[model samples]
Target: MIRTLLALNGALIRGALAFVLTTQEDIEVVAEVERAEDIGTALRTQRPDVAVADVNLFGAGVLSAGGASSGPPPVLVLVDPRRPKVLGDALRARCQRLGFLGSDVAPERVVEAVRRLAHGGSVVDADLVVAALNRDNPLTAREVEVLEIAAEGWPVVEIASKLSLSSGTVRNHLCRIAGKTGARTRIEAVRIARERGWI
Candidate 1:
């Protein structure tokens, strides 16, 4: 049996995880924690084979400085499907095991993900993979810089002033970016580009 540690921000998500694991004959939830501060203690006490952590726990920061310890169990992150590539890149950069799940995934899929991860396998939902790939259109350095600022809900006029470009030029660049990414709006283009590591 794969003894698992459940670390999630929401009580509902935690309860759902526990219910799913209980249904699996070869999986057991050995411990539960809600914060990064509690992770070490839980790992030490639970001695679990795998830890399933929600991406919300990490926020915008990279993994904690001493996040990975020799005695700590392997971690598999559950992340939003729309931002899988961004989360995947962060996990990969840390040399950590990861699994991506849409917020709406069923309990059976979560159990299967946990099982696969416990066995040293990586899992990313199929739809998320397609979305990541589809968002991979390359953007120029200048275009990406502009898009990053624009993504913060900035106006074209403001973006032009900040980047020392004419408003028309900013609009033109945004149009090109949207076309390349098959996005109808600048916000969608920026989100897709950022998620795919293009910006």
Candidate 2:
């Protein structure tokens, strides 16, 4: 039997996952956790063979430099295709045992992914794999820094103050960022950057 732990966020998602996975004769939902903070404790305590987690909750940090004997169990991370940055984070993690599936995938796909991870195999959705390949962050280091602040709703003057740059310089950077990203507004630039996993 495959022992699995779930660390998805929503109660409905959690309940549905448990019901679906439990119906599999070879799979058992040993633990379910709603908050990101509970994953570590559940992992250590339950010692499940596989874990299914939300990308937002598990983060790339879950794939730290440790094997199953020293770290968390192999994880199958469900990602939102619209949020390429989350997928980028998981790709950069580079864990051999980790798997990826689109959040909107059919329940059978989830079951397949979980089984793949349980067998120490890697799985990634075809669309996500393509996105990972095409996702090139076009912004330079400084531009990304500026856009990050802008994305947080900071004003130009405050951003300049925080970055220790003149107001005019910050404005220039913003203008260039817009040009580079082909964005009409600061908010749009940030959104574009986030969608492409640039910032």
> Which 10 successive residues of model 1 have the least lDDT summed?
59-68
lDDT of candidate 1 at residue 68, scale 0 to 100 = 33
Error of 1 at 156 (Å): 3.1
1-199 in candidate 1: lDDT tens per residue? 9988888888887987788797889998888878877776666666777777777664322233233355445566666766656655545545466667665688788888888878888887777666666765478888888898998998999999999999999999998888888899887887677656577
Count clashing residue pairs per candidate: 0, 0
| Top model number, TM-score | 2
Clashing pairs in 1: none
Candidate lDDT (C-alpha), each: 0.74, 0.83
Tens-place lDDT digits, model 2, residues 1-199: 9989888989999899899999999999988988776776777667788889899888533554232475667889898887767787777775567788988899999998888888878888988878777777778888888899999999999999989999999999999999988999999998888877788
User: Whole-model lDDT, candidate 2?
Assistant: 0.83
After aligning candidate 2 to the native by TM-score, how far in Å is the CA of 101 from where it should be? Answer: 1.4
CA error at residue 7 for candidate 2, angstroms: 0.9
